[model samples]
Target: MRKVIFYILISWWLVACNSSVISPEMVDECPPIYPDYVGVTIPATIAPMNFSCLDGEYERVDVTVTGGKSGEVHVNDKIVLFPQDEWQSLLKENQGDSLMFTVCIKKEGKWKQYRPFPMYVSSYPIDYGVVYRKIAPGFEVYSKMGIYERDLSTFEERPLLENTMVPGMCLNCHAFNKTNPDHMSIHIRGQHGATLMQIEGECELLDTKADSILSACVYPYWHPSGKYIAYSVNNTRQSFHAVKDERVEVLDLASDVVVYHPETHELLLSPLLQKKEVFETFPVFSSDGRKLYFCSAEAKPIPEAYKEIRYNLCSIDFNPEHGTFGDRVDTLIHAAAMKKSISFPRPSYDGKYIMYTLSDYGNFSIWHKEADLWLLNLQDGTKRPIEEVNSEDTESFHNWSSNSRWFVFSSRRGDGLYTRLYLACIDEDGRVSKPFLLPQENPWEYYDRSIYSYNVPEFTNMPVELERRKVERGIVSDKRIQVKVRQ
Candidate 1:
């Protein structure tokens, strides 16, 4: 009957996709995307023009300059000065002379001049991701701290989230992060103690009073609903039983405004193991925001270390209404059939399919061997290899487009240590097309030094805040809010 027809239809679609071939012309057709290059310049000193330089040159001399993202160096767009003239007004007042400026050509937005730093350099801006490190020795700029916006065409850095927040050393692991909608979070470590911050203009301290329940919060994930924010808190300061345990907590963003609102709380599940006893971490929400999926290792100290260092994907159904989660569980994948370790599970926007990377840690270099892409069906839980999309080369860090019809991921399959971003189309039948590399006109790509580790890719629809504002304004027509949280 109808059930048989559906099965037959699904089978035909799967066969057609497996036998399909992607062409090179498709790569040329992709629209160009440029990296937001932030150019800066700093003098050895910042005193008045007379004494600002070690040479003690010029009297009240006017050091004129201009800059900005568009390359237009107008009065307040992007410029810096030593004597504090009209350009100074455009800068974040009180900004030191070491301030960076941008002078955009009225025509192409090509930077006219970018003062070189005394000690360090910049990372290339590729589609997947970009990591910048400050080279100055006593320089306070954290390696992981930098202004990030969905579209930098009109971005302005806020002190709370950008400047006065992240500690220099902690930036790498607690790098700048953006959650669902307009919600942003950062792990701000200061002289008093470390606090898990969640805010847009400023870093709101989640554990300001130095609470003992958690030591430090990092690696935050925003629930799709934007009402909840979750992060892993360190418990190294506390005494442990035979079983070492860390806690993951969620905050009520709407009501958790105080230093630590009473409404805020942690999940009772403390690194629970599956029937086989494995440790789990790095949880992500499904498209429907019902299930929490993450990677798990064996339960032994380092416990559950995939003898091969391979991690399995697992999930826990969470019912937000009931405010509780079900038991720890594994997906239906034949765990033993995987070749290399499976890492970084990313569910598509439609919730119909999931994509992940497959590779061996020994061949950690993205250039050493290929990290193939695999797809799984959420309906019946059927899994298969994406043959045309993978190579003996490295391919990881996949992200979905706003429509779910397109996806962007990173791969060094044929390109050496050079991992670039690719855009692929997914059909209605759940078939993934060949990946097309991002075609920015420039040949200068952001090259990552960590051979084994490539940049992690994340995608979003529009600005995070705008989306949240729409929900608050009731402009969205979807009645999905009525959908119950899965338990």
Candidate 2:
């Protein structure tokens, strides 16, 4: 069989430092270049490491790979994921002696589970090596998962549970948080049995009045110091008729109390909170945890009037030292062009600018529908159109990377209806470059089908050394990964 062996640089070298195996440092060598953009070509008989089913039913087989490069690998049929049999493939070396190849599996006559798995071409000149890992069944269900390592070789699964929030509840705003290395938080609905669980080792309830206050909390921002979490809750009734036109409330983490719309608010008032008040939500706290930015709107009565969900971004002074949220809440940006809704306000790491989404709540279509990205300058409160980035279609649910150099947000620029992850580079002058879709072609393979979702992507700023150590020995100081509960 024709085999393609690839090489990995020493970049991924961490923990064990096995000179014989590829390390994490080699990861940078593999970029996600598409075939149309840049093709990869490998040279020589350098054999990349191999993987097969533990059953050992399929014997070791050799295949050669040619014309394959780091991000782009050419694999016709060697890469396969058959649960019943053993699978093996070869890696080839680039002219520079690097490793690169694509892997895939065939199931039910369809060529699926294909990914560009970057390999390390053994400069050691070894003919072959063994790759080992047990297959996780297709039945296991997951709530919210993020890509820690994106390239095929190092890309592994990591959970947001260390801080306790479900994927379904969070993907709307916070995809993942790089700021919090260990414990992560997610927004959940307390209305229909959905509760926010704190993920320390496992998901547990975060004991606070928030448990009883808002009907649902969508996006959560962790404080820079990791002491508190700021989130917004929808204070609407569970009735389908009531939710379509409910209001939002912002909550303070330190005291587990409702700061913006206190318990006295209309949503919390009557036999079912008989009295009524205005609605507010989408609370995003600055990195320093001093200012809390949110959106507020007057609640409407008609469901068809859902398009009336017009909320303008606003903020209040927050004092982390005394756990006191001061008054003086003011509106940052409110455009009548939104026709109604302005939500999901995300602040940059430096606290210089804010990005938010504008959409009509009535019709959620991306085509003729309109949703765009807007920026709010905190300096002089200047606002303008970011034409290079926003379009009439839809651009919402955005968050910044730790370095604040790149930001990830979901958009419907491609297939109108299907929302995909897009990464845009933030220039030094605060101008955002054109956005590109996430490299992973099938990142949304496992998600709810009916709704036009797939949002709240959180990026991690984990150190290179930390990821290297993880891939080498599969060991982490975090208790969640180390221990397993038996079924």
Candidate 3:
């Protein structure tokens, strides 16, 4: 009798579950979802992009994702949470194909099925992972900050370094040489400040603050050869605004650009870059390392004249063999004439195009609401804004992948406060596709509740292998290698 009762209970429970799944009314409108994954192109190696229904009237939601060739996934919830194994199997079998989603919602004792949508799966693969800084988008006072790397294939993040290791220190401007993990440069600001450089897996601390320079290194870019690094030293100050739309204004009192040779512990100073009348910053090297590009603007009175400051895109010939600069500087884009400022001039690895952030007037574009990404065709010198990839909110700090076919940028599109990472693809003809937000297991839950902002999103071909304890010890120690100015 006991065995028969147990079997009857099991049968009743199964019936309850199956009976709850009702037949849909077959609505014509499509279902509302967050992160807008519909009609977007996704990489096969990326994690499942979980999303939830935007319509609050629904009590329960069911999703059926069917691949073109082999696999299918059935999920039941208010949020579309996919199983990892099933998602992977579906993507693996349907590469260069499409996935169709059939969404059904339960509301007020009734079920409604919406029209299905499709998402294209790209045949091309993305990088291994990306490294970025997680910080609150605040001014002056930063509570906690760290640099972290995230694996694209999964939602695993590890810290390269954190302020908890050494209190009162802030890290920024983390860069790599052509996505090579063995070579990187990071700057730490505060009392124990130094430029930590990793060369061929060896880490060293360098005091970049030379007496001859006005200030320490602010922005950095590594040459393709990994022998030299270009940095900008700026005496910067910030002022608060009284207006409601704008909050803060950052101005450079004085600035100059210099190149540093790590092997010789020497700073390569050029008279053209160090001109007293001009403010130079955001230095970058061409793909072949034969040309150096930087932003320059005429010096103006601080705070009072900040609105008039605009940077023009300029390039100068670089002789990597002897670490010398050319005599003449060519103005690639006359941003000043157009009443605009340019920052973060990054050239693609293929040398076909250059990507930069254009704003109304200052170099610090993250704070500028009008900032957007613009691309320059190096072959034809034709420049235009990437409308497909830009948004109304601030779009700043972008980097290209190793193949130059994909790019990642920081945008505050979701909340207009915290920045998030977005990725887009560029074809051979320089046409940019629609950008999608970075995938999370539950994008709606994660982005809505998270307080941290993603900063300086850079793509890395491999994981950054650095021992945390060793790096912390080096940062806290007093031992510092002073860099010499090459006279």
**Which one wins on lDDT?**
3
TM-score of each: 0.51, 0.53, 0.96
The residue ranges of model 1 lying beyond 4 angstroms of the native Cα positions read 1-147, 150-167, 172-180, 188-203, 207-215, 232-277, 300-307, 334-339, 361-368, 444-454, 464-487
Q: Decide which is better by TM-score, 1 or 2.
A: 2
Better of 1 and 2 by lDDT: 2
Per residue, candidate 3 scores C-alpha lDDT tens digits across 334-391 of 8999999999999999999999999999899987889999999999989999999888
Worst 10 residues of 1 by lDDT: 249-258
Instruction: Please report, as a residue range, the 10-residue window in candidate 3 with the lowest summed lDDT.
Output: 15-24
lDDT (10s digit) by residue, model 1, range 285-370: 67777877765544333222323444566677766555455665656453434545565566776788878766653112233254
Cα lDDT listed for each candidate: 0.40, 0.42, 0.89
* Residue 451 lDDT, candidate 2, scale 0-100: 39
Candidate 1 residue 70 C-alpha distance from true site, Å: 30
| lDDT (Cα, tens digit) per residue for candidate 2, span 249-328 | 22221111133221111111111111134455666778667877767665566444445556667667777665456645
Question: The CA-based lDDT of model 1 is what?
Answer: 0.40
